[model samples]
Target chain A: MMYLFFLTALFMGWSLGANDAANVFGAAVGTKMISFRSAALVSSVCVIAGAVLLGEGSSEGLNSLGNIDSLLAASIVLLSAGITVMLMTRLGLPVSTSQAIIGAIVASNLFFHEPLHLESVSKIALTWVYSPLLAFLISFALYAAIRWIINHMRIHLLMIDHYNRILLFIAGAAGAFALGANNIANVVGLFIFPFEKAQVTLLPFFPRLSTQLFFLGSLAIGAGIITFSKRVMITMGNSLFELYAVSAFVVVISSALVLLLFSSQSLSQFLQHRGLPSFPLIPVSQSQSSVGAVLGIAAARKGWHSIRRGLLLKIAAGWVATPLGAALITYVSFSFLSLFIDL
Target chain B: MKLFTGKNKMLMSNIDSFLQLIGDSSTYFHKALESYLSSDENTFTEYLKKVSVIEHEADELLKKVKHDLYAFMLIPDTRADVFRFINDLDNIIDSSKQLLVQLSIQRPLFSPSLSDGIISLVTVNCESMKALIETASVFFRQPSLVENRALAVIRCEEKVDAIGERIEREIFSLESSYSLSEKMQLSQFNRQICSLSDLAEDIARDLIIFALKRMV
Candidate 1:
């Protein structure tokens, strides 16, 4: 049972990598700044570092999903959620892995008559509102600032172009780090407490086996991105909007900041007291945040006329459907699996 | 017309004929339009023959650029855009030739501003083309100078637009003692110069857009 639960977390990590890394270097590849191979190599390293360093916050959020004592049930939920997101990605519909996992957890709770935490559920829903709104406001400000600098400084184009490349690369790295730290829970959260109860053994040199489990999850996520992120990168970069390097950088950084600010538990608790809102670390799909940023930048530059209304509607509908769709599939799969296994 | 095939002789041969033809024709077209404006019939006749010959030579040069584009399949650099730029220069000459031919044939009196507007439009295009030619010739030797050359070309194209718009407005307001048919023909002649100027501007814009895409 212990081994099966660990394997379930690994599968979840793979889905997280496939769906989320698209946010890190998708725009850069879309704008032809770097090739797919370079984006993969850069993002993989930075994502791992972010997970190892700042992945703790979301690990707690993952704990709120309730206990999974039956390894068979958890495995069913994991397999169903993984297949759902992978199929969506293959079809070029950018679905959220975080949403899939949350829905699965909710469905798993339904099977046992466990009450859902309305606070966590509401936080998840609120992210849907704030992410796009924040991205729109921030990108508008960034573009306006860039235009003002260009007009006032009268900087030489050659010098600016050279420097802008370096700045874009660094921003790309930060975006990758933010992705890992904020998104690690989508992979390893289910197994965090489970691993401790199971007494998973590791080398004596390492103090805690949980730290090793986190590293393993991050590594699996990196592998998933390296193997299958090219298609998503092209779809995100080219389909939504064509971007300049500066605009791409601004969107990527803005997305990472939004995730970082909203996902922090302390930040959310502080905001709630002051009548400001916060979102759950879970279900804040990086892809949705990125799409919002791109739309925001496009809108700020050319007004609402610049956006493709049909595409925006399609994306919004997909956002609502992904989790519900995944939950239904997982719930049915769990019922069928329970007839065979008596756990 | 020399038969020498040595390297130095060939280098001098290509530069002397092409450069001199372009340089002399650009100057002649510039002055012929001015002479036509001032109603200096003697000056117009003296420069007309030279300008017509220059236009023919420019046409032949453009044909070579087209031939070179197909012959060199790889296109050492962005020679297609350069060819397009040269074709625009050829068009400006073609329009000037037609204008001169019409002026001699019709022999109608014209408003001073009408001729002045046409002359200024032609001058702007000629100056822009000269800068473009110089930039393309030195591009390979100094690749790092792409932005500078591109900015200069863009600025020159804008000036051509400004002058063309001025000329277009002048044609509508001109008063002439010619027949209605003659006025339409004169108006069309003025339009040809402005359109030719616009053609040059389009080529320059295409070249700059292409070059920037490649460099950055």
Candidate 2:
């Protein structure tokens, strides 16, 4: 009964993986530049590597924001976020796991009478704006460079196809790695206190207990990719945007760079030690970053007129609604849970 | 990177050979037309047979390239445009086959004055095809250079059109001994020969637009 609570986190991880895996490999699979099988395999393997290795920094940031010390409390927080994602997606509303988890964490902190870390909250909110903007800028610069190179090279059409396939695979792998590293925190970071005590030893081998939980979380994400991501990936390829192989390559690379910017401790440390401003280690949404990267590409290819202004406004609205929805749901759920069990 | 597998390399070589076959077919078309004008039946038949054989080989190569492109290897993004122009080259080969076969079937006796004009028209068509093939070849390797090569084709097409008109007028205004039906037959043959250059010119114009995409 006690351990059953972690299953919610596992569910959260699964959903996160299923949805975000598309963000990484969707364009490649959709464009027929990469096969679904190759995309899934590379995403799974690299996701696990990222979760186990680079997942630490962002999880620490989530803990600073708020960590529920009790298993029941942690489960409630994660489940609330999971339910919010599922409900919003079902309603065809734009949703983000990062916003949901942050909202749930803040709600849980309020429920437990813990002081909210405003600094961490502010840092996270800032990244919500910065992540996509960063992705857009990165995509713009990368697309320009790639376009120039392709024109100047004058390679045979077959040779260009060969290079696109090769580059798309490598970019997909990097995107997957960044996905796992950046997003594992959203899956299990709230359960840090419980995970710290309850060791994860049986599954993916790792040195630290959090690393093991990340391994477990990443497996669920990998499972999500294999089981449910095929349609999502193909749909992304076919109708969502119809990205060319080079465009897909650029999107994935930009998203990965944005995620890495938020998650890499060494990069942050290097920036801080040199007195340069560093992005806070926060789990920004990969899906949002991808949308931003796409917008950047559209803007670069055409101009601002090319960007769908309606979609931009809708996503901005979702940013506000997701967190408030998760917080409201978590607060109400806490009330319901308290009636049945002591907090 | 090794760049291409053995299978892909073979496919690429197949595409190259197909373009070469079109060029070869153009040469044969010229030879066949020249021999027919000279009334050398034996040599005309020989060149016609060569064109037919090259047409068959080029078709086989086209089928393989089409298969490979559709099978998800070559027919990706901008490459689709490249293949479309490449596909147009096959039409050139087919035109050569049609013209040679028609000549072989009719074997009309060309007037002595008309033979020179007909030969001049065929020469222009040949030059136009040469430039068309060059435009396609450059499109694959150096698309930036395709504009000049394609323009060369258009220029040849202009020469072909002028010669074709002069020949048609000459046939119609020939000596009173020439029968009306005989003049009509020669005019029809002249028009068919000019049509090949027209096809080349159309492909070259489209290639310019496609090659512009490749540049920026």
Per-residue alpha-carbon lDDT of candidate 1 for residues A224-340, written as tens digits (9 for 90 to 100): 888888888778765432426456667787788777765566676888889975555653667777777878777877788998887677567666677676788878887776788
Reference-based TM-score, model 2: 0.92
Chain A only TM-scores, each candidate in turn: 0.85, 0.94
lDDT of 2 by residue, A271-334 (tens): 9999999989989888788888988888888887899988788778778888988999999999
lDDT of 2 at A280: 91
Write candidate 2's Cα lDDT for B127-187 as tens digits. 8888888888888778789899998999999898899999999999999888999888888
DockQ of each: 0.05, 0.36
Give me the displacement of residue B71 in model 1, in angstroms: 22
* Model 2, position B53: C-alpha lDDT score: 95
Reference-based lDDT, each prediction: 0.66, 0.83
- Please state the error at residue B87 of candidate 2 in Å: 2.6
Which lDDT value does model 1 have at A211?
58
Best by lDDT: 2
